[model samples]
Target chain A: MMIEESFVNGNSLIHRLNPVLKIGFAIIYSFVVAVSSKFPSLFAALFIALFLVILARLNPRKAAVRLAAVNGIIILFWFFLPFTFQGEALFHIGPFAVTRPGVIFAAGITLKANAILIAFIALVATMRVTTLGHALNSMLIPEKLVQFFLLTYRYLFVIQTEYQKLTRAVKVRGFRPGTNLHTYRTYAYLAGMLFVRASVRGERVYQAMLCRGFKGKFYSLHEYSISKADITCAVFMTAAIVILVVLEWTKII
Target chain B: MDKDNLIINLTDISFSYPEGAPLLNNLSMQFYKGDRVGLIGPNGGGKTTLFHIIMGLLKPYSGKIEIFGKPVREEKDFRSVRQRIGLLFQDSDDQLFSPTVLEDVAFGPLNLGKSVDEAKVIARKNLDSLGLSGFEDRITYKLSGGEKRMVSLATVLAMEPEILLLDEPSAGLDENTRASLIKVLTGLDLSYILISHEMEFLDSTTTSVYIMKDGKVFMNGDRQIHRHYHIHPHSALPHRHESGFGKKYTDFLA
Candidate 1:
């Protein structure tokens, strides 16, 4: 539901593009922002990405909640990077000095990451995985690869369900979380048991597929036909990125 | 009643697991086109195994099985027969694999080589006919058990098979969903074989019944079997009954 909520508000020109085209444009945009070393360029790109995110019509508060949960580890890394990397001392503390370059480098990495994250969230949060797969196939991606992507997305949920069931079963057996090494070992063993159970369930799923005439190909009703509007939107987004990049190169404000 | 148009025929069919535990032994029966037969038995009576064998999903150790008047011996024959016979599995979770309801319902038609648009039309028609409109975009995992079962049946219906094999179609449904399912099942024109423990549903929906005992056909008849078994409205199990058919069937099992 959070994912669904994140897709509710966008009416921007970029949001109107085909999902596949948006994904491609996002990939290109993220790559360009990632390799650039100029602070002004990165800052401009981040601003544009945030603007596009707003255009997507997504609820900023809901998006923030979902992203906060998923990106906790990334935020932790960002927090530690400035302290760990030593550079020219901007100021000295009891044990650590914050260097100017270190700060800039960290800022650059953070900006690049945020840009990539925004693009992905905009594309995936709005489109269902089935729609995304069909759009990719319509763009002439290999059917086998598309099938793999679809299956992986489906099984990810299946695995999560299995894990929940295992945890419940363990709890019913009176297993409680604790701080000792033995408890840690028990958790590891449960994780191993979860993998085994998932594999067995996977085999049963495969058998079910075979029964239903799954001959190494996934079949779905979702279809994507690229229209003139799709092409126009893709071209417009590309043109906007080119103009932005060129203006930056020309040192225009 | 014509014998030549018999859709399914089993003779001396015996099946055992790979470890040599027998599941079905010398079971023989014939199903005519348009027959709505209900299979009933206690647990471990090989009801599901018999259904699997009839669908050609599982092979019997010995005996001859013919579907649509053709013997099933190889994978190609099984595939052809399977396409004509739709099997609605017991677990909706096992049957409905796709992420969305529309995709899961369209899977059978698409596999049978229908184009995307054609499959969509078929899937939509089936879903709508089952009164599951507005569910096309819903995720499969999020659906309730009864809804999942209805969607699973819709998937098979999209294939337009002549024969339908349902395993416990009303196992865990509430009264409302079960009543709706009964209405749908009664309206279907295809020949159907239902495996269920719902005695009331079986009595109301099926014209004939086959009870399995010890992996063999014990009793096959019209509503008379239900009467003789004393499965009446007020009666429970272990009722007194004549022993001719029951004794013979038990002897066949021994």
Candidate 2:
């Protein structure tokens, strides 16, 4: 299955926080994980991220799949770093010697990546896209950028649907992927036609928007007010992140 | 507010594209409350363009449009009244632009400044009225053609407008769906102007009919309707049949 922004529903504290504050918490969590190199602090951060994941009620198997895919790519850099770094040698692999500093660096990078991903999946992915856009706009994000995000999310399904229809038509004609010129030309033509039709559809959608009293700014019937509970969650999460980073810096950990 | 008892009155409306000849040439008509008017014409005969002109999507060079006894002269003039008069586009894709079915239906009420909860209530009610339930979270791209058309109509009806302007509503519907659509439209209490090429659908829905050509109204109160529809350009006769005012319309045809 394709990895999408699949939001899970739960009544955990993480789910009730304001989306803007959740974004801030994710940023702070990622920063603390990135700057810390101590194994104990990184391990603590990883465990906290996992606990939040469980608290948010996200499926562990689904979360593991994404983490595995990310780690699979990062592991490629480890092979070269261990051989290229000039440090105290630890192990030998045929002609290249693995170094201690390279091993520690790779371990740190892996932990940081996992911690950040877990934090994002727990804190940010729990909200709906429309509410997320509204939260960002309320946080003084430029209207244009907010609209850009909204339109992109809204029309992505439309674009995917159009492409699927085109692909189906081509398949019905017995076309298949190959390295031949005929297949490549047909694919190129299909893409061009889809773009042209999409452009025309875009204009008609705009006219429909105008007919329905659409101004430049998007207006929704629901207005979100930051609740007291949401404020408490945000403040608590921010403080936790700060204390974790300070303890790591002081080596008290 | 409607002292004239006229829901819509357009006097000598004329409009054209910059590169083309007159699309609407001296068009004039009047519609009253409780009037289900059928507007029929050939391809590119200014039917849809007339709807745009009335909705203030397109501005006419020299013409006057009155909606509910108030003159509409500019694009902004239509904002307040636009929500009161729903315009159903020719394409359901254009109308149901929201990602989810519920959101699409809720758009009109939301735009009219209804609370989100109130808009959802109205949307659910309209969808239920159309026999569509448990479809709130369905994405737009996944719906069938008939379902899309029904959802588009649901969005329009959710607004609870005083008048409806429908364009080619029966174009892509199947037999059963079209029948259901006719039944739904027949049961409506509000006035509407239906533009379609399907004469049977129009006859089933409209109380009176207008045949347009060369950007002008052909159906009139006189018998000289043949001058436009046959001999000249789109001159018309209103229901020139035995069921229509007990007159054999063949005599009016040139």
Candidate 3:
């Protein structure tokens, strides 16, 4: 279901583009935005990303909720950084002081974090993980690395489901966590059992792979070539980033 | 049975867990080309263990298995033999680890060194034949149980295996899905051995039946034997006329 919800949208142009192109465009855009120290350039890049999100027609409110959650964590780091560092104080509080340079540094961090997060969420949330793996593999990423990513993504839910089942099984067996040695031992035993189950399942999965004639490689068929639209999109985005960099260097945008 | 065309030969096969619990004991069987065999038994009867043995995924503590007249002892022998046979696990989630339905279906063929385009063609044909054409892009985990089973079958079928081994092909399936599966099984020309407790489905789809009890073959017969035992070909197990396939078969043996 993760794959279906991630890809297979009904009649969307963005869905039709080769996954490799989308990933390449996203990486290039994010790198350019992250490398730019000028606020204006970063802001411009953010606007273009926002425009793409709108064009993709994803739920704005959902996107906003996810963005808030990610940015909230970064903001925690931002809030604590100034307090932990020694700098010329703009203002003094009971135990902490705000400084001008700290604020600028925090602003830079916030910009970089938000830009990367937005770009990633825009591309990843819209594209299926499998498609991303295929794209990466076609781009000549190592087979082992691609397989690792694929297996990790595939089994993440399996492990979580197993954990849920274990918890349910324990609860059914009247397991209670008391402040006692027995309870701690029970918990330790359960954890050990989970590891053993996962490892055994992992071995079975490997055997299943071998039975299917897997010979140390994973293969996918993605024949969609980079079309004129893809090239145009990549080139146009690259040109915009260049303009932003030049404008920022000249202090004129 | 054509002795000359025996595709799978198991002799005195016995297996036990590392902890000394018995699973399969002195089991022997033979399957011929183009045979439609159903393996049936109660729960914990080692039906799956026997399938794994034939697929060479598991080793027996004793006895030998010959696939296409070649003794299977090592993984290297299994590598060549497994290519000739396809095994569909009971759990589609276990069988399908790929991201997309299409990729999972194409996995077997691609691994057998088929070109990407050729593999895609075969995968697409199998998916389409299963009435799952547009579902190629769908994710494997998100599919319904029936759909997942279909895709699992497609994956194996795409490999063009001569022998198909299915473990509980009808378990967890709805009536309509079961009927569709029966249709698929009946239509398939390749030799297949299906392990299931669904007597009706088995009786309807299989040319011969082998029941496993305590890890060994308990009964072997044809449709006439099933009919004489009053096993309905359309009803689930434990029919009112009889205690059940499991109970009746066990009682007969006792």
Candidate 4:
């Protein structure tokens, strides 16, 4: 029940775009943004990512929450970078000089990370993870790797359920948590039991697959077709990536 | 019964885990076409292990196994057996690996070399038969326990297997769901070896019962073998029954 694919349920243009194209473009766009050091290019990248997010028609509050989570981690960089990195000393913080370049460096990282993550959220996260696996397969990812990814995603819920059951069993037996060797040992045993059960379940799952005539090959039930909208979006996104790269290397911001 | 009608034949099958106690010792069992057999036993009684051996999921260390009168040996031999006979695992979580119900049901069909569209059609038809018609796109793991079990059955039935090996198909089902399950099993034309502990359910779904214990078929008789097959009313007192397995299987109903 906790498997929340928050952005997947939508009829937005970005959501309708071909997942293979979305994944491919997200990778290319992220690469361009990552190497772009100039503020103008980074800001342009951020603008494009935000534009895609807007095109996705995601709930504004949810989008804001996702951005907040990204920035929360970036805030840790803000704490250290301004005072640590060797650069032009701007001011003193308790005898440690805060460098202007360090602040700028951190700012650039914040922009780059947000730009890439937002684009990924808008393009890639809008599709179900199962769809992503099939898309990756179509995009020439190794079949074994795709199967591994999909199977892992599928069993995560089962493993979580097993974990909850073990926790509940211990809790009902009056097991209380505290900083003690007994607690540590009990937790270790719980974790160990989870792994053992998971492994056993894995074996049974494989056997079930065998029962169903699962040879080495995996067949996807979904067949994705490129619509006119998908083609138009693909062209536009390709153009955007080209423009971002051009802007990074050229003076024409 | 003629040997030609034997659906599954296991003779002197002995299986044991590595460095563990014997799980199945000299167990022999037979299934004829059109036979609805219910296998029942206590925990660790090798009921599941025997099912595994029948499905070729586990190979007996020493035994002779045959399926539909064909001698099944080598790893390759089980492929055709799997194609002809579907095994529904005890755990729906294990049986359903696909993310969606449709995909999971379609998995077996697709693997059996059906075209994607053909497999989808079969999957849909099977789901419809199980009254899960509108659940094509439902996430597999998000389904309620009963719904998951039904979908798991759909997955197995999608293969159009000649025989079904259901391991505890009614384990976690509530009364209403279990009743519906019994109805479904009783209505199916295909033969199946249903493994369940609920005597009433087995009595309702199967024509015969085989009690497995000490790694062998301890008792085999008609469905009326156990007098406890009747559902005791809630107001009834606790009682014991002679299962003819030389054991007093007690029912603490009050």
Best by lDDT: 4
> Whole-model lDDT for model 2 versus the true structure?
0.80
From the highest DockQ down, the ranking of the candidates is 4, 3, 1, 2
Candidate 1 structure quality by residue, lDDT tens digits, A17-77? 6777877777778777777777777777777777777767677887687667646766776
Candidate 1 regions exceeding 4 Å error are A1-16, A67-80, A83-87, A179-197, A225-232, A243-253, B222-254
Backbone clash pairs for candidate 3 read A1-B141, A1-B142
- Listed in order, each prediction's TM-score against the native is 0.85, 0.79, 0.86, 0.93
* Top TM-score model: 4
lDDT string, candidate 3, B1-254, tens digits: 67789999999999987887789989888888988888867787788888888878888889988989889898899899888999998878788888888888888989989999888899999999888899988867778999989899998888888999999999999999899989988988899999876668878888877777777885456322264344347757644544445545445433
TM-scores (chain A) of the candidates: 0.80, 0.90, 0.86, 0.96
How accurate locally is residue A109 in candidate 4, as Cα lDDT from 0 to 100? 98
Q: Rank by TM-score, descending?
A: 4, 3, 1, 2
Specify the poorest-scoring 10-residue window by lDDT in model 2 chain B: B223-232
Which ten-residue region of model 2 chain A has the weakest summed lDDT? Answer: A1-10
Least well predicted 10-residue stretch by lDDT in candidate 4 chain B: B245-254
Candidate 2, residues B1-254: lDDT per residue as tens digits?
Answer: 25466888899999998999999998998888888877876778888988888888889988889998899886778986687788888888878777678888888777777888998999999999888899888877569989989998998898788899999889989999999999999998989999876656776888777777768977663432221222334548543433332444433322
CAPRI-wise, candidate 4 is: high
User: Candidate 1: how close is chain B to the reference, as a TM-score?
Assistant: 0.87
Cα lDDT, all candidates: 0.78, 0.80, 0.79, 0.88
lDDT of 1 by residue, B15-126 (tens): 9988877889999988889899888777778988898888776889899999888899877778787788888888777787788899888887888888999889998999
Docking class of 3: medium
Error of 4 at B134 (Å): 1.2
Model 3 regions lying over 4 Å from their true place: A1-18, A32-38, A84-88, A94-96, A171-193, A244-253, B218-248
Worst 10 residues of 1 chain B by lDDT: B222-231
